[model samples]
Target: MTVPAFSLRNAVRASAPLAGALLLVGCVTGSDIEGLHRHVGDVEKRVDALAKQSSSKEEVAKLNENLGKQVATLLRSNADLGAKFDELTRELQTLAGKLEDANRRLAQLSQQLAETQARLAAAAPPDAAALPTSEATPGTAPPVAPAPAVASAPPRGGAPSPADLYAQATADYQRGQFELAREGFEDYVERYGRTDLSDDAQYWAGESLLAQKKPREAIAAFEKLFKTWPESDKAPAAHLKKGVAHLDLGEKAQAIVQLQFVVHEYPSSDEAKSARQRLKALGSDSR
Candidate 1:
């Protein structure tokens, strides 16, 4: 804009000098006046061209400003999308935990029922199979007395089933009885390690230990889960907990390693989001 305006001013100045020259030379001819008019027309055309070029430059700048705003808006939208994804990940983890507990309970009940039926069937058949088909004669070998029936049902008092044990341990954890919950969960995993809830039990045991301020023990518990149940659904959470345990013990380097593992290994998991947050807090790379 400034360059065009400067050219226009200089053109006006030059035209003034020409008009003065025309006035000074009273003998100027019609042809000379015509030539001067043509010169003025050319100057006018040049000014118009420069003005148009300046306008085009302004329009280009406006377009660039709009593009920058759009880019900033897109970046904000992407951040919002990432936050929503983290929320969904947390919700999915919660639902999966609930489903796992339900399955464990149902499976445990079915197994206990089948075992009871098998025991009763085995106890009753032995008596019949031992009896002789014909009546016993005096000289005949005396019929062997039937062995005592093995009890199928528990006595009036008995320990709870695996399902009940797990439920009680979860209840204790919910009630803030971390020590008791830790013991119960460890016991379940030790005795019923093949059960569906074993991995879940082990994970909760680590949680219990962490809650009790025993971060060292909690790290061990979480490590046990990783070694014994590497394919468990709770592996991501276990990694996250282990990282937190390290933090509690002021083991910054180890904590960062564990947190980064979760972020890289389970990027779509809720635990990964938590791990990233922790990594960011520690001034480490989350990726």
Candidate 2:
């Protein structure tokens, strides 16, 4: 029979802050014990005995069986402590893996964003002042063309430009106004779908639904984002969030599939770290 899943909340609490440092200490301790077990060398055997004093109470108890009851009890107590340390070491290694994955993703995101910015800068319109000047005849000014008539006047209450719409949507999201944010983001996506920020607008529209606890709607929104912008920079994040939405709806199987896809396809992404954590919480083997 399968073992019951461990409580993620409890695990998080036990890990606290110093978990990573402890992993290194545990690795050293385990390695020393291993070398002695294998009879690697005299020096290693000496290190192993010392390390084992603090790392394995069972060994101490067996070796000092002829000692007094007090010594036996102390040795047993140390063994129990060692067991707990071993468990903590395993948990710390898992956390370290997740942290390393997250850092790699952040670096990739920074690089991708920098490249996007560079492309945008390179594509920016030339300054009007850089336009070539035409020489006028000595006695006359250059002929000027009449400005084109406005096709339509600006609305009495000026409609928000694309940038204004995006800012308003982001502010609404930050303020926890999920419904308003959803509407604003949807509007932005609909009106400016060809703009650079459209993918971001689409992604946040799903996030707003998620914030409102509408996981079904959020899933649909995320699906639409993927369908509409398959090549979007936000695609991996959208997949990750979609998996979370599935979890919120208690669709464990679908959640696993979506999260696994992120892990395999975007292994170096921050979203993949989150996906892996969720998979761990769900007792799914990401490997």
Candidate 3:
């Protein structure tokens, strides 16, 4: 039987060059057609691969954009944390300053208390009853004419009554008898609280309290003098003493207040000068 002839019209139109060669060679072989078909399939695969590569590039660019945003966010968060840390450090510094001020005031108060206690101890007098009597008398015997009636002890110097008492107290105070001096000064105040010397007595009383380590009591005494004799010469000194007592009591604000009053209210007074010096030592005075 005869084999049917393959159609060449459609096959030649698909590849003109190949069809021309085939016509020239008198016919196209199966191996040649298969090679051309395989070549066309490879070109299609290369085009598809290029398209996939372009898509991957676009995806990579999007990932990069997302990473940049994340980095920016992290930077902003770090800046905020840094600010918070600075604020906390400043607060700690402020608290430390306040504590230092408090401690300074406490130390001042303690010193004042000790001084007052020492003064009080030195002022006490010996008991009179403990001394031996120089003479004795029998009951109902007229005391043998009373030993010729001895004269009374004369007052020292020609000073005023209050001045005499003050002098005696001053002597005892100079001798380191703080308790005796304190009693004498108190007695003078009781007898002359309305007199010109009363202010002086009050001032000495406060000093005696301070020397006896009773700073709280000394402060009270000084305060009384200030309030009762605000226009007196002792006012400035009283305020100064009050400041010292307040310092001893660990009241820095209160002590500063009193010291400032002495410096400002009595700027020309000697006490004001002393207050200024003290304030400078404490690092509290600016002017």
Q: Give the TM-score of each candidate.
A: 0.46, 0.46, 0.43
Which portions of model 1 miss their true places by more than 4 Å? 1-157
TM-score of 1: 0.46
**Model 1: lDDT of residue 32:** 79
User: Better model by TM-score, 2 or 3?
Assistant: 2
CA lDDT of each candidate? Answer: 0.76, 0.71, 0.68
Candidate number that wins on TM-score, 1 or 3: 1
Determine which window of 10 residues in candidate 1 has minimal summed lDDT.
137-146
Residue 8 lDDT in model 1? 83
**Candidate 2 local Cα displacement, residue 169, angstroms:** 1.0
Per model, how many backbone clashes are there? 0, 0, 22
